[model samples]
Target: MKRARTIAWIKGLVAIVVTAVVFLVPFAFVLLQAAKTPDDASNLTFSWPTHWQFFQNLRDVLATNDGLIWRAFANSAILTVGSVTIMVILAAMVGYVLQRKASRLNPVINFFVLAGLIVPPAVVPTIWLLQGVGLFKTMFGMILVEATFGLSFCILLFRAFVGTIPRELDEAAVLDGAGPIRLFFRVILPLLRPVIVTVIVVQAVAVFNDFAGPLYFLPGDENATVQLTLYQFQGQNLSFYNLLFMDILLITIPPLVAYIFFNRQIVAGLTSGAVKG
Candidate 1:
């Protein structure tokens, strides 16, 4: 028993050390770079700043290109909120129906859902379609793209969670004269809290961090998302390493703060439907 306890203790210590090295070290490096003088940051070493310029670097990054970073942050927030809202509503409805209804088309729908996960998006075709629909370079268009891309995974999560819900609640709601909308909104959706929170946090972070989607689908500085703002500090001949790291640190905070606060909820949501009682 003592030998087993010793091994477990050693294993836990090793895991903690590995986690700190893998995650904390990179974050510390970025922090150090962001706080350094321009010359110090340029060296890109994991050393403390010779002259700390954290606030100055932050001001410069935020004020670059007439405060493009602020605009990028606003656009990213809007896009993340819009896309995640659409995904949660649509995925929940589809998952509920697919799980509850007995339809021959379920298999076909399932195939397409899985295909959405497997198939890489055709960017050229998507852009062409957006252009044809007059949605090119529009916020709404980017929202649609983000929502659609994330829908399949959200569906799978919702469907798995729906299975854990008893059918008696549905019958009871119907017996109480509840319509489908009310049944879902009032009765079912409340029960879907776990998976809903999971989907929102996960997908919101993804949409906010997405670079290529905004780069290709929503071009122009006005529509620039947070990830696109990274280009501001980068140039062909010159790069502002301090300001670049500052921007990265700034943009990384929202997602980091979100995960920190909702960490437990995310874990519970993800594992809640893993085993149905």
Candidate 2:
């Protein structure tokens, strides 16, 4: 018994150590590089900077291209918020219906939803479709794209979570003369806060940091997202490593902070939803 316990403890410690080293090494390197003076940063070596210029690097990153970084940040915010809001609400409602309603088409619909998980998106066709709808190269178009791409995962999570909820609650709400909308908003939604938070955090991070969707679906300088702004610090021949790292550090803070603070909530939400019918 003692030997087994000791082995498990050792395994856990090794896993923690490996995880920490994997995540923290690159982060520490970026932090150190971002703090270096331009000359020192240009070297791109691991040695400590003789003169730290964290503020200068931040200012440079922000001020470049007439404050384009801020605009990219704003675009990312709009995309993240719009996509996540719609994703959460629609996914939750649809998940509830799918879990509760029994119909001939339910299995077919469920199969397609599950199929969405494996099927890769056709970028060219999506772009052509958006163009036909006159939404191409637009922020709204990108928002819809991000939402659609994330919808399947969100629906699955919500469906699993909703199954764990008692059907008695729905019946109670209906007995009280509540409609579907009221039942969902007033009764079921409040109970779904945990999984909802998980969806929001995960989807927000994914959409905010996404590079390819914006790159392919919404091209051009005006529609550039935070991830797109990384190119600004790099040129054909030369690159500003300091400003580049600073930009990365700036754009990375929100999701990093979200995960750091709500990590426990994320875990709880994910695990709590596993008690399916």
Best by lDDT: 1
Kindly give the number of clashing pairs for every candidate: 0, 0
> Candidates' TM-scores?
0.98, 0.94
lDDT of 2: 0.91
lDDT of 2 by residue, 1-277 (tens): 9999999999999999998899887888899899988778889888888998999888888899999988899989999999999899889988889998988998898898888889999999999999999999999999899999999999988988999999999999999999989999999999999999999999999999999999999898888899999999889998888889999899889999999999997998888877665
How close to the true structure is residue 3 of candidate 2, measured as C-alpha lDDT?
100
Candidate 2 lDDT trough over 10 residues, lowest sum:
268-277
Per-residue accuracy of model 1 over 1-277 as CA lDDT, tens digit each: 9999999999999999999999899999999999998889889899989999899999899889999999999999999999999999999999999989889999999999999999999999999999999999999999999999999999999998999999999999999999999999999999999999999999999999999999999999999988989998889988889999999999889999999999898998889878872
Number of the predicted model whose TM-score against the real structure is largest:
1
So what's the TM-score on candidate 2? 0.94
